[model samples]
Every structure is written in structure tokens, then in C-alpha cells.
Target: MKKRRRDLIQLSILVVLGAAVILSLVLPQLPGRGRELQPLELSVIFREADTALWSNTRLGMEQAAGDLGAELRFLTLTRTGDGAEQTELLRREADGGAGALVVVPADPENLKLQLSETVGSCPVVSIESPLEGAGLVVAPDNEALGRELAEAVLEDWRGGMVLLLDTAVGSTGVAARLDGAEAVLTAAGVPVFRQTAAPGRLAAGLRVLSSVQKAEAIMAFDPYATEQTIRAVEAGGLGQLVYGVGVSTYVVGALERGSAAAVAAWSDYAAGYLAAEGAIRLARGEAYTAEELPFTVVRGEDIYEADNQKLLFPVTS
Candidate 1:
């Protein structure tokens, strides 16, 4: 009887081994199991010529590309707000066999028009600006970001004129931010004046406007504008409390030095990482969903906090 029991145990072990081999073969064939995705070629186009503003974003993209086995080509316009140039670049990248296209649209309306005409088979993902019917969009809620900035100003604002500076005049994202800030300030019975400047002339414009308009506080709607506004304020000795949106190094430094009061910032690092990953998944025919990253209002005191530090300064390595 003992010999019979030993033989039965050996038979059971053999049966288990056979089942494992069958599973190993069949599992790979099943959906969502051990599938090797093809390496993808991704193209990213930014709306502006200054790639410096997108440094953290680029790092995030590079990290995702390395992790996901994808090749990335980064492109930017020769001038800010060059819709025609952006369209041409999009067409060239797609026709040159890019598996996916990611864009910070210089002109969202123009890009939406080009999407069907230019991109034949490749999927398109938009970052920082939303394109309706585009596969996915990864960005912060611009309106909310604006409201946050405005609220930061309202915290200590007793009363007086507040200037809403619009450096990127045509950007829907920037416009949304301006609108949000306006809504909040207007609802609070604050007098707000909307201001606009030509690209590359915001500093000069601010210098001229501040000399005449007499705003008690200045709120810039984008990163470049915010940086320029802060510099203009300090250089002119305008004494207007500066508040804006963005988290660039200069903006952070200004906040630390108390030249700028506060900034509404989101993680551009997360934005870049999500855009690349979303494009790859769309290229691979996998499921992808639009992502809206959150924002934070960083003041002088909040800059060094652990959570805010990560939001403001992402570790590239």
C-alpha cells in the first residue's frame, strides 16, 4: 500500500508539470497577457521657439521613452504663434513615418483643421492645449490655474486696480486662464483690466503700461509672461505685487526673493510623461484616457515644502 501511494504522488507531480507547460504556451496568446509591444516612433511639437521653457517637460518625455522603448523627435516653431510653420512640421513628421504625434498647439483651431488632412494613420495627442476629438490631451485645467492665481492675489489685496496681462494672446489655454481670473476678481468686486502685448514685447509693454495704467497688482497668464512681468516690475521699481502662472526657474527664484508674491503652477514633468505615454498607447492600439494634471499655488513660504518642491522642481535623474 505504501508503494502504491508513492506512485500516485509521482503521477500527480507529472500532471502538474504538464499543465504548467500548456499554460505557458497558451497564456501569451490570451489578451492582456505577456504581449510584447512594438517600439514606437513619437514626434513632439511645441508651440514656441524657446525650448528652455520646456526643459522639465523634455526630461519627462525622455524618461518615458527610455522606459517604453520608443524613439522621440522634438520639434518647435521658429517663432511663437506660427500656425503655418506648426502645421508644416506636423505634416512632415507624420509623413516621415512617425507612429504618433504630440503637439502643444500654436493654434488649436488651425491644428484641428489639419488633423484629418495631414495625419493619415498616426494618432495625435495634444499637451498644454486641448484639441477636441484629438485622441488624448494632457494638461492642467487652465481656467482653474487662473482662478488659483487670482485667489492668491486676493488673499492680501485690500483694493485697487489689478492688471490681467496676456502675453500669449492667441492661446486658448492662456485665454482660459485669463477668463478664470477675471471671473473670480469680478465676482469679488475688484476692478480688473485686461492687457495684451505682442510676442517678445511683453516686458517693454509692461514697462510702458505700468508707467501709465497704475495697477495695484499685476497678474500674468503664462510662464514667459510671468517671468517678464516679474523682471519688469523689479527693474522699473513698480511696487505692484506680482502674481502669475508658471514654475520656471526664474519664476521660482522671483518667488523665493519675494519679487513675485505667488504663482499657480502644475507639473509640466507629469504633462510630458503622460503625453508621450498616451501617444505610444494610442499608436499600439491600447486603451488611453485624457489626463488633466493638478496645479498648486506656491508662495514664498510654500516653495520649500516637500510636496511643493516636487511640483516645482522635478528630479530628472
Candidate 2:
């Protein structure tokens, strides 16, 4: 009888130990399995000091951030066309623990090192102009844009003098477009002249116009430059010039006024939307690739068309 009692006690102890082991394993998955993820905060910095270009990009980013339930901090460098100042602002944002960064570097090449440093701990996406070492770049294919502009000019004007107006020499977008224009113009046996505008000088347009000996077409690379060129051309009695092309709202307005032959524009809203989406994906440990937004050509006659208008500003369209 005592032996039987001893066996029962041994069985009871084994059952208790087994129950304890099972409880330890099951308790961990009960109501607390993994650590909760912290809410993400994203920062977007615009290179342009003025908020003129910020409108569409801001609208897209705000909408995307809202839909994704993420916090967004909008920061501006407050100076137009200053690369150094923009880089400083990016460093500050990154040091402050922003989970992701979206930047439009004023100078892509000069700002690459600084941008890479800032983006080391977080994802960095670029709009309009791309920098090296960026997580994702969102812009139009500038070479394609340039080629299209050149083709348009060549088709309309037959082998007459043509001048190309570029804002800066070192910009990737400007260089790409310039190369494309050069290739097309050369292939068509069209004589081409190239000129550079001073940084932030509207009077450069007047200077360029004065220097042109005889040109049937003037291709302005930027929208504001195109507008200034139109004013200068009109002032100099060169309104008879066949074609003017550029990129900008002012240029679009010039097209509306019959001053421009064609304008190439990528959806600023789509750029912003892509940047925001890229940031969110990075924050969530997801993968994304560099994206090139499509471009649209706005002609003088189609400037007011609904489809063209949609390309000008993407958010509302």
C-alpha cells in the first residue's frame, strides 16, 4: 500500500512540472506577442526658397501622409536657388530624428555628399532634380524632354538660326536636356546657338536677346526665363520669332499668350505623391525603386485644353 502511494506522488509531481512548462510557453503569446511599432514622422524640405513650387508638392504629400496615418513636418529653406542653405536644412532635419526625408536639392552634384550623410540613418527621396545616393528619385526624363523640344522646333522652323537658353551649366536636368536638344538639332542639320543666363537675373533674357544676331526660334530652358524672353523679344520687336519653349507656369502663361511654341512639364503633384509614398515604404521596411514621372508637352493651341491642364497640376486634376 505504501509503495502504491509513493507511485501516485511521483505521478502528481510529473503532471505539475509538465503543466508549468506548458504555461511558460503559452503565456508569452497571450495578449503580448511582439513589440508595438512607434508612429512614424516624416520630413520634406524644398530647395526653392519661395513657396511657388511648393503648392502642388505640398498638397500631394499632405494627402498621402493623411491616408497612411503618418506625421509629416514641412520645412522650407526660405531662399531660392541656394544649394548650401538647403543642405544645412536637411542636416538639421535628420539630426532631429526624422524617420524619413524628402529633399529637392538645389545642386544635385554639389549636394550629394551632404545628402548621403543625412540619408544614412533614414530614407531620402528627391524630386525635380536627383542627387547621387538617393533612395528614390522622382522626376521626368530630361533627355527625352529636350529631344521633344528640339523636334518641335525643327519641324516648325526650317534650318533657320536657333538659340538655346539654359539657366545653369552643371545641373543634371539642364545638361540632359541640352544634350538631347543638341543631338536632335545636329541630326536635322539645324544651326544652334547656346547661351547661359545669370543666376537669378531676369535681365539675362535681355542680354541674350541682344546677343542673338539672327535666329528664327529661341528655346528658353526655364519657364520664368521663357517669360522674360517673350517680354524681351516683344520689346525688341522680335515677336515674329516662330517658336519659344520652356518649363514653368510663367512659360505656360506665355504659351497661352502665344509667346511659346511648346512647354515640357512633369506633374509636380505626382512627384510629391511619389516622394511621400517612397518615404512611407521605407519607414515600413518595404522596398521601392527610383521613379520617373511622365512629361507633357503644352502647345500654344492646347494650353487651355483639359488634358493639358491635368498635366500642369496633378492633384486636383
Which one is best on TM-score? Answer: 1
Which window of 10 residues has the lowest lDDT sum in candidate 2?
239-248
Q: Which stretches of candidate 1 lie over 4 Å from their true place?
A: 1-38, 210-212
- Which model scores highest in lDDT? 1
Residue 307 in model 1: lDDT: 98
What does candidate 2's lDDT look like per residue over 258-299, in tens digits?
Answer: 766777776777677788988888867898875577877667
Q: Whole-model lDDT, candidate 2?
A: 0.71
For each candidate, the alpha-carbon lDDT, in order, equals 0.84, 0.71
Error of 2 at 19 (Å): 27
What's the C-alpha lDDT at position 84 in model 2?
77
Cα RMSD of predicted structure 2: 8.1
How displaced is residue 255 in candidate 2, in Å? 1.4
Candidate 1 matches the true fold with a TM-score of: 0.85
